[model samples]
Target: MSKSIKLLAMFGFVAAVAACTSGQTEEEYVVVNPEPISVEPTYTGKYK
Candidate 1:
């Protein structure tokens, strides 16, 4: 029983540390690169 309590406490401490450190310390920037406005044309016609 004592061992189980100690393990639980240790696990809780590790979880608390992880949660605290993961609080978004830096701002997240979403970089959006737009696709080209015009697409390349393909030739589908027969030439005489």
Candidate 2:
């Protein structure tokens, strides 16, 4: 029917607009190594 054709055309137009606008990249990420932590030994006094 004519109504179905109009609805299909509208859907196609919307799909085309969405497809055109969805291909943008805005951000990028990079991975890096983390720093190591150092530990100090605990000293015990000469008491029981």
lDDT of 2 at 10: 100
lDDT of 2 by residue, 1-45 (tens): 999999999999999999888887557889998886877767787
Question: What RMSD does each model have against the real structure?
Answer: 6.3, 5.9
lDDT of 1 by residue, 1-48 (tens): 999999999999999999999896978799999999999978878872
Q: Where does candidate 1 stray beyond 4 Å?
A: 28-48
What TM-score does candidate 2 reach? Answer: 0.51
C-alpha lDDT of residue 29 in model 2: 88
| Model 1 root-mean-square deviation | 6.3
- Worst lDDT window (10 residues) for model 2? 39-48
